[model samples]
Target chain A: MQDIKEILWEICKAPGSPGQEGAARQAVKAVLEKVCPQAVLNDDPMGNLTAFLGDKHSQNQLLFDAHLDQIGMVVTGITEEGFLHLAPCGGVDRRVLPGSPVDVYGKERLTGIVCCQPPHLSDGKAEKVEPVEEMYVDLGLSRAQAEEMVRPGDAVLLHVEPRQMLGARVTAAGLDNRAGVAVLLRCAQLLGGKPLSCGVTFLFSSREEIGCEGARVAAYQVQPSQAVVVDVSFARQPGVPPQKSGSMGAGMMIGTAPSLDACVTSRLIALCKEHGWDYQMEVMGGRTGTNADVIGITRAGVPTGLISVPLRYMHTTAETIDCKDAEYTAQLLAAYVQEKGGALDG
Target chain B: MADLKLLEELCSLYGVSGNEGPVRQKLCDLLTPFADRIETDALGNLLVYKQGKQRPKTRLMISAHMDEVGLIVTHITDDGLLKFATVGGIDNRILCGKQVMVNGHYGVIGGKPVHLMKGEEREKAVAVDDLSIDIGAMNRAQAEQAVSLGDTVGFVSGFDRFGNKVRARALDDRAGCAIVAGLVQSELAYDMTFVFCVQEEIGLRGARVAAYQVQPQAAIVVECTTAADLSGVGAGKQVCRLGEGPVVPFMDRSTIYDREYYELAFRLARENGLLCQTKQRIAGGNDAGAIHVSRGGVRTVSVSVPCRYLHSPMGMIAQEDFDAAQTLTALLAEHIAGHPAV
Candidate 1:
């Protein structure tokens, strides 16, 4: 099996601006083909990529979901000067946008730096965060050159490389859902070694950052009886209260919320206990803010569960997570699949 | 032309102000082969005396800073988060959500997610007091084991060139340093002194002492000045512009530059058919702030490359401007050294 860290870094490196997820979807497809050869792959019109392993005719199918899209900006206008006027495509953190470097996917791949005033140039009195639309991108190009090379609808992504930190921790710009995508990919790799008794469908949905549009449509197409959503939740960092987050590197966070099926949630917990794998409880009041909310009500309502990798600095270029937590998440997911496959009575 | 490869190497090294040992050492190694006499000053300034064929009538010194702005660890929190204070003037707007290196370990700066911020909190930038560097440590003990109270933190950025531009961290003075180093390697019209000063971002502390020690009759401070020719900013507010040319400031916040040398710079650039510009706004200062006032006064002028977003993680400069700055600095140095000013 490929090292999980390498797989995570490879997926995170691909740009997947929301609603323009072709690049990221291609990366995940290549890895899925290598990791699980027996699986049949399919792409829906809504931009969701799905892979089915085992008998597609079975009614007892298990669905796994992870969003492939990440937050980014799109070019809205080019100024009379060479600067690019932008509108963020997803929940791009305005606070981090200033002075951040970006990669513009246009007629050509152009490198740009978001415009910002250093304190020496500004009034130096009140510090304010500019709205995303107000900030301009400087590609170091002339006005005529910019218009010739770029259009209004090109995608722009934060250009931070995925880096390894101390131990198994890693940092990258698109770790929000790519971390979850890595978890699902690793889960498929583990499930490939065993005799699958139940059909499994992996859904790498699109555009979860703006809304669950892709998940809502893709889940209806997959039509699984039960589903599990793999995504990222807040990890304990400074200023974040401990109650609302899981400890990084502690384990996978098995989500418990009102909208989640109690049986799927408890079964994951029991499997964690049986396998002696590290785990944490991520409790939510109502709807877990994940694809679980949309995937649950798909076509007569599929029962869905949530598993999250404890990540720090979400929706920014500095999103970080521990690689071991991904391993823990994959272990719990593979265990759940095994428990469900045993019930097939083959 | 300036040595961009050297500039990239200089920018890649981490040498925040007050801890410029790494940058100073690199400069010393690069300049030693070209220098007749080189030694480090008390405040860590690398002073090199490159000998020419014949000594000129006027004493001359050309200088650039060796230090860049960065963060220093002030305290490690109970949860292993390292609190830091900016070593120089860094805007609070650029401090959040940046990746940094604390004592050679990879760390990231972040605060509460935007989803957790309240209405007013979202409008205002996160103050430096609220931000901390997370280096994947679990507790204070582990953080203390990895980092100390005074370890410096530098931004982690890659040097990249696209179109007619370059982007990287520490380009503020590294571009200047590369220009000066490149000059030291070339044949000079007259013998001169080259000082790569330290702690320029905090204040002109290093240049102050180096000027007092060198006591040259004339000085030229090579630097990277702010360029605010942005999309929304007005033309008057644009201190200088990239791609227009090198900048010669008649007056900035720190010094009223020598009128004769100031005119001399533009005159020489025009005569040589090189693009040159004057700083339109008197907003920034450089080592010229201190050098022009050292010991009965030195006739000093500043030649700068107009840079966008100075003191941020990634600063930008036009490749044409960098080459022009180097050629202009050399021409000004040679002419001033031969002039009968002393």
Candidate 2:
């Protein structure tokens, strides 16, 4: 568990923005090599990495995927007062950005604070919130010094660290996906001696925060018969519909979509029941908005299933998740892979 | 004549939006010689197949729409001019004074002369209702002889080369049809399905049905896109330039391309020394709108020829760009056919 926590810590701290996911790629690659030493690590032109486990001659192939990239910042311009104008690499809530601390990674590292006009400087009453365009980051440096440390196109990440909340709950930045990646790593480590009936491939994908770009390439290259995309789903948060949100410590959530093959979902459900694991159902009306949407359409079409870890405040600097839920997800995946022999019936 | 002679023959065939029998028959004739099996779907999409020696490791579907922008005659005026509505996204501004062929019959558009217009009316572009087709008919009886109500009409023009560029009507997709035709003439290693789809000008109706039926592992759409590289347009909004080779879209409004497929295309373009540009802006939809969502889903990519004044009677495109698109598509087909699913 401590090793898994360290892996998560390292991954969340890495800076990888959309279209510029090399840093996260290197971090994920280092961890993947440590767990699956014999696994082949190859990156497609899209920067998607596929790590293969077990023998190639295995009759069936199962692929598990988790996107490596996280939401961050790209410096679009710099103001004269050492403030930085930034564009979101992925979707970011502009309202929460003000007063948040960020680490700008350009030619060198620099810490900055997101600032807006103080109420005293504004007209007696203005719009309560400003658009992201009007916002800027103050690095507490002179214009010349800030310009020397950071330039346009440099990446920046939230200056937040992982902290254990209420015993089982953990709060961190980028738990939206790095937690899923940690689950895959832990699953790989747990299933070492247990003989697998089929070949398994683990993919720590890149560029998913922007779009499912990495999953698109990994699925095409692997062309697996069966695919499982592990990502984070929104949990029960304040003002969120109770029915729609998955419970935080209630266990793993299985996605149900018209695009998701019924047989795959049922098989996963049956596996969870067989293993006596706590599980819940999530209904996806149209698109799953995960890698499952991409993997389901690859080539002749692959039957895909999704296992989600419940997280609150997704796509934010202070995203929160329960560590037990992540472990349960890993356990569910390991059980499904080990007991996936019978003909899949919807 | 070069292979373009075949292309010209294809372009000359009349296949307006709803009625595409003439174009379908012509494509069938041209594809029969090169295909192992040729068939048509319920929506009139032409599917031509060439089997490979190996049990097809991958099923590749290459598509180009056969339908061109035209007008469907809705009413005939008492003065013998034909009142029509456009079947696709037609620039109403270009409708006046343009010559159109009604279902292969020659005609000229008749509308109010510029001198007869009132204040502010002259500044505004002509609407569809104000324009009508004149086929030298004195009455409705005489107008029925040359064309009829509900008859489809399109620009009656031929391709002409000026320097390295080619100007023509309906190049919005006839150029795409020609590229697919060129690929069919080449040797392919993987089992290939060439679809000359119909009704693409309207809403990609034919592509939707074709993708549902073929259920291909991967698809590549050959298309002609709007080239806004004119003098007035700014650099950021200049969608494409003529003779800049084929343009591959990274993200279009309709679909975001599969990253692996997009990377594979870029790598292939680099290795072959072919000139290709990525669509920087996400605008316009194509057959990919249907191809990306068909069945479970397909890894899809689009290669387009940059054309000026798309959806107008006189669209212009560079022949070199068309040729470049054809060469790259053929090369990709060969590479995928020989290699594994990756």
Candidate 3:
């Protein structure tokens, strides 16, 4: 069996910012092709890749959604000195931007650094974080040379290698959603080559960072009786309240929100208990901040549930998670799909 | 030409301020083969004397620091987080969300996630005091097993070359050290003393002591100074620039360099057809600060490579400028050693 960490590292290494999801989409497809080769895979106009398994004609079809896009920047303009100005493609955190390294996908891949004022030049006081629009990316090239290589609207991703930390924890730039994508791929690995009563369709949706457009469009086409969205949620770190976030290395976070299907959430919790697997409760008052919020209201209002792998340092290059959490999340998902006669009524 | 391969190897070694054992050991190994005598002082400075074809009329000393700016673990929180303080001048804005290596373990400096931050907090920069290094430890006991207090933390950056520029950590002084290393490996015209001093970042403490020990008649401090030629920054604020060759400063925040040596640097560069520039602003200091003020004072001038993003995880320098700094330092050192006292 392919390790989930290996799968996650491969997926996170691929750069896919919002509308530019081709690379990440292909990464997810490669994993699925290796683990679940019997499943039929296809893409939609919006770049959403769907892998279908089991009897497609079954009335009780289930869809799993995970975003393939990550937060990054797009080149907006270039200065006379060749520094490239940028606009955030998603909700990029301004605080962690200064002095960060990035990769600009231009005519060819070029390494760039976010311009940061050296302390010697500053007034030695805590300065306000500059908005991404005001910041520039230094390509270490002259104005004329930079213009020859890079252009406006080129994609730029914060460049940090996938690093294995102590124990099961790992950190990477695209771990925000790649962790979820890896979970779905592992889930497919478990359910592959096995007979199931209901059909399963895994949707590696695109452009979820900008909006839930990919999930919204893909759900309308699949029209499943029930859906579950797997994405990363807040993991407990310093300054984050315990009630608002789950602990890292704990387990899967079974999300409970007003927008979710209660039956599916309960079923997932029940399966975790039955299998002696660990999990934590993620309670939300209103809509869960995931693609589940959009997929639930798709078509004639499909009953959608949410599951998240606890992640820390979101929207930055240091997004971290435990590889064990992803494995357990996959186990819960596989158990949910394999339960006799998979159908949820809300 | 500057040896980029040597510079890359030197940059990869960790040598934060007071914790410069690894850097000192490496330099000793590289210089031992080419030295007349090699000895380390109590303060960990690698003092090497190289005999040449002829003894100089004036005793000359060439200096480059072996230390780089980094962080040190100050405290370990009960939750397995490590609190650190900057060992040297580091921009607080660049501390967050950066990968670091504390001792041998990989860790990341992070604070509250942006989604959890409220009000003006999202737009405000995090102070170094508020950040912590998380190495995936669960509690204080687990963290203690992996790291200890006062452990040096170095930024994890790999050497990269693109176009005419090279980027890596520790380029500030490592580039300077690489230039001196090249000279030590070559044939010289006059006897000279080379001192790779320690803890220069913490206040030029190492150079201060080394100068007192050597007490040369004239000194040449090879360094890498800040070049703020960034986009949108005004030309007046750009103290120096890359690809402009070596920077010879007249006066800075630290020392008013020797008049004769400062002029001599520019004249020598012009005579040799080397690209050279002067710092446009009186900002930033180096070992020249401490070395020039030693007992009875020594005539010292700084010949530096203009570097961008100095004291940060990644610093950039033009290859052409690096080559120029290396050649000019060799030429300037030879002239100073052979010239008679006026």
Instruction: Report the C-alpha lDDT of model 1 over A1-346, residue by residue, as the tens digit.
Output: 1367878877887888888899899999888888887778899888899988776777778899999999899999899989999998887789888898899999878889999975765675447888899999999888899999999999999888877777788888889989899988998888885777788899999999899999999988888989999999999886678889999989999999999988888888888899888999999999998999999999899888999999998887789998999988887888777776724232
Expressed as tens digits, the lDDT of each residue in A216-316 for candidate 3 is: 99999999988989999999888789998999988889999899999989998989899998899999999998999999998789888899999988887
| Highest-lDDT candidate | 3
Model 1 CA deviation exceeding 4 Å by range? A124-126, A340-346
In model 2, how large is the Cα lDDT of residue A12?
Answer: 75
**Residue B124 local lDDT, model 3:** 85
DockQ of 3: 0.77
The two-chain DockQ for each candidate, comma-separated, is 0.71, 0.01, 0.77
Model 2 Cα shift for residue B236 (angstroms): 36
Please write out the lDDT profile of model 1 over residues B1-342, one tens digit for every residue. 789999999998888998989888888888899999999989999999988877977899899998999999999999888998999888889888899998879998976777766787776788888889988777899888889999999998889998789999999899999999999999998999999999999999999999999999999999999999899999888889889999999999999999999999999999988899989887889999999899999999999999999999999999999999999999999999988885
Q: Candidate 2, residues A311-341: lDDT per residue as tens digits?
A: 7667755466777788878877777777753
The residue-level lDDT of candidate 2 at A254 comes to 94
User: Can you tell me which runs of candidate 2 are displaced by over 4 Å?
Assistant: A1-3, A124-127, A341-346, B1-342
Clashing pairs in 1: none
**Which candidate, 1 or 3, would have the higher DockQ against the true structure?**
3
